[model samples]
Target: MAKAFRTVLGERLRRLGKSIWWRHCTAAAFLVASLFVLPARALDNMSFVVRGGEDELTESFRAASLLVQSWNDGLTDPQTLFAAARADYGRLVGAAYAEGFYSVVVRIEIDGREAATIEPLDAPAAMREIRVTIEPGPRFTFATARMRPYAPGTQLPPAYGDTKPAFSTAIVDAAEAGVDGWRNVGHAKARVADQSITADHSADTIDSLILLEPGPRVRFGQMTISGAERMRPERIARIAGFPTGETFDPEELDTVANRLRRTGAFRSVALQEAETLGFGDTLDVDLVVAEEALRRFGVGAELSSTEGLNLSGYWLHRNLFGGAERLRVDGAIDRIGGQGDTLGYELGARIERPATPVTDASAFVEARVGREELADITLDKIELSFGLTRVLSDTLSAEAGISYIHTRAEDVTGSFEFDMVALPVSLTWERRDNPIDARKGFYLQADVTPFYGFNMTDSGAQFKADARAYRSFGAEDRLTLAGRVQLGTVVGTSLAATSPDFLFFSGGGGTVRGQPYQSLTVPLVRPSGVTVQTGGLSFAGMSGELRAGITEKIGAVAFYDAGFVSDDAIFGGNSDWHAGAGLGLRYDTGFGPIRLDVGLPVSGTTDDGVQIYVGIGQAF
Candidate 1:
């Protein structure tokens, strides 16, 4: 019985081996067939080469030629290659004209024969090479260039009538300047009436005559609003602040469009001028806006060695009341990985009304409640504030507010409760080209808040000023130098009597980063022979950074920060200085740059060897 079973098993194994061999042969045959058939159906392999031009000129010709860009992988057939080569001839000639080569010869060859001479039906079965050769003739110089009927104060470029190469771009630029000169002075209907250009191949010179018609100076008549669904038309007009009945200035139109967009209610805003002039030398402007969705929400997070992890979120309603009113609610929690009891929380809400009976002005009301436990203090606070903000210009603004705060605090000095009322006012001016990553400009802000405590005889005024400047050098602003100075002082009362929140404490991410959070403070000696940090009454901080962009999306920064916290209302003999130096890495994104900094204390009291901070945006 064993012998019979062995014979049956051997037969089954042999059958299985035969079946596997047949399947392998079938796959090999299929692969060989595919290799042979795919090539016959595939597109022809074509190569493009640009000759007769060198360096930037060669690159410019290639960039301008559509045929060069269209032949990405290869051409489908000889017919497609012929079509592409024919189109590239005109593009190459135009590119030469733009570079002051009025007389240029462009030749495209396919497989060693001119493409233009070949008939479509006689094209080769497969194309191997496409060659474009350019003969850029003698460059032309501007011999005579003139523009007529330009506004009296118009300024044209120096190359307009010089012996320099007569670039086509220069002629267009001169015409634009003539028209813009009129638009700047209230002639909104100005346009280029006629252009006469002649290129002399024999003399290697070009002559250009551009005539501009500055239509009669007009005034702004009215503004018609469109694309309003949830927002009111009247509110849109009010917020835009179009200067009606005033001389028509193109800048005013731009200002109106920018203002409407800044409200965050619109996805797009356009101001279109009437085609024909209106009666009484006036032009009616039309404002077309596409509104965005009403609600938006976002969440953000940050990490710090001393403060632990912070997480925050916000919700916004763009048109909460149909008048472009904005409402926002936000909350945050910090110190998530701390010593279990040092968690901090905050909740706040704000509502804003635009165009509050004044041009470029808004009113807002806000309320907040929070609890915080720092290194040497624990505090709980509730606050309410109402404010008016005015936009004086594109780069300047002012704000004034009244606030009430109730606080309960505990420190080494024991626990205390106080109610305070304050009147805060501030003015800010900023001219940075980019707020998130400033390359150049200056910023200045000054603030003053006077407060009165109801629980004790404490009345004082806090004054603070911040000034920053940014300057860039090198190609594409690859190197940026930024500096900032901050000054603050509390007057009219002692530090102990003032509200703890209003007092100044240095040594945190916002100040001297290498030290522990709020670790640098004035020492107060108690009767029990123990001294503790009790915050400071006056403070001054200075920071400077040298940021160098190593690549398009990568940057490195070296920074130094110094701060002083004083026991008196101003700097005195008892004041001490603390400093920190650090290097950082930045990765730029669409919204802003991701930042990581490692800081080390160079002066003052810092027990931690090194501190690290990770967040979005610049430290400033």
Candidate 2:
């Protein structure tokens, strides 16, 4: 059994994420210590013999033989060897029972003496050979299988009944399924009242029965808060949103936890049910919260050969007003030294109040001011917005906001000014396993902003969507395939009248990697018959990557990206497309991955020697 344990432990240790390493440490600690002791070998080799069973079953017996592991690990202590052999009997029998073999015979021999007959205190200091023999009896089938008082939607395993081997695990699963079903339907204390199990050796059959006790249905009561500092108890209770006096649903506990977690005020949250029901059969739960620090700050940077270096930083106040409000201020500077691109800078601030208006919603006000100096234009802008964002489910959210914007611009043609009011609506659905380095699942986001211009600015709507999917395969999920598609269009507006910030561009690290920043642009004929470069009205882009793991923390990637830009709402008017292919390397730091990519122009007229990009997280 130790051998099987060590094998499974080795695999699990490699597969463990940092959050779960504490679970299996106790059982393996001593054995891991033994690995460094340099103990001499008592036995040269151990033999595992099975008199009757399939090849797979025989292999299972070998794995369950602790004597085999003792020899393999080169442990010479006779008492240790004897203890391991003695313990393996129960382990082997349990393994047999798991395979529907109720009657199994197991024996271990140490130097021609039956280990079961040898006394523990009489262990020899030295031994030459150790062998184990196992005979698994005929598998049993279920002659009668039944569990009573199932809830409305209970689903039992199909193999628990007739015409199949009666696995012991199936019986346990059925019992758990029955209890969970009752809990799903408001029975908060359902349990198994009685169980009867019998085996008929002569007929090679088994009979099983389980009776469930579905305790009285219940309603939810108030939540008592604990472990909170610098946060009001009333707000914590409000965010919990427990349906006091309403029929209980088991999923509500998870919902309440998520609500508090999304506020970012708590580092950890836990709910404990009362030992006894409250008055009127109400279920009261205690909410324990460990508050996060009041303040935090972080910085990030990204570099591109053509677009230069981009650096950003932010300061956060988790509990700005003792009501789970978050205040964040951030700034960014980019285009330090690029291929014809000028410096740009942006500063923004946002304040978010959680559980405002409703438990699942938050309200926020944001303000921003920025300046950009591009190859063909120089612009400055200021904006203010207020909005409500609601969490519809674990993986979906929606937001709507109204904003006022003003901009001043100087292009090659002349100078321009615009003032606009806009309403922006967005939806996001995300199911990725890890946001920073996704291994599976998909993400989708769509936004529509309709703007009303004052005098000469264009009245139009901006439509944009980004969709990404990741699929991983092979042992330990060592290979992943990731893909992304981006689409955008501006409708009810003329190309020359649209704000430069709202227009679409396809180049730099964000679109076609190997192409120069904003190099792929549409031509706009000025009133004087001269033409200048300008952003397109419509855009489409696609990126795909195949990643292979080189080690536990290192990986390699091959990717291709292509983009299209058009002057018309659709692809009817003048259009240009470009493509770039790249190979990259990644080093995972648990929090996220360090990314490095080298790109070369694959299908574009403007080809640079090569482009290098460095950043954090995946490209998408």
Residue 338 alpha-carbon offset, candidate 1, angstroms? 3.0
Residue range 440-517, candidate 1, lDDT tens digits: 998999999999878763888999999999999999889999999999988988766777777787886788877777
Which residue pairs overlap in candidate 2's backbone?
1-64
The positional error of residue 478 in candidate 2, measured at the CA in angstroms, is 2.7
Candidate 2 per-residue C-alpha lDDT over 380-423 given as tens digits, one digit per residue, 9 for 90 to 100? 99999999999999999999999999988777678888889999
Q: Give the runs in model 1 whose Cα sits over 4 Å from its true position.
A: 1-54, 71-80, 118-125, 339-341, 453-457, 472-479, 525-531, 548-554
Checking candidate 1 for backbone clashes, the offending pairs are none
Q: After superposition, how far is residue 99 of candidate 1 from its true place, in Å?
A: 1.6
Tell me the deviation in Å of residue 4 in model 2: 26
Best by TM-score: 2
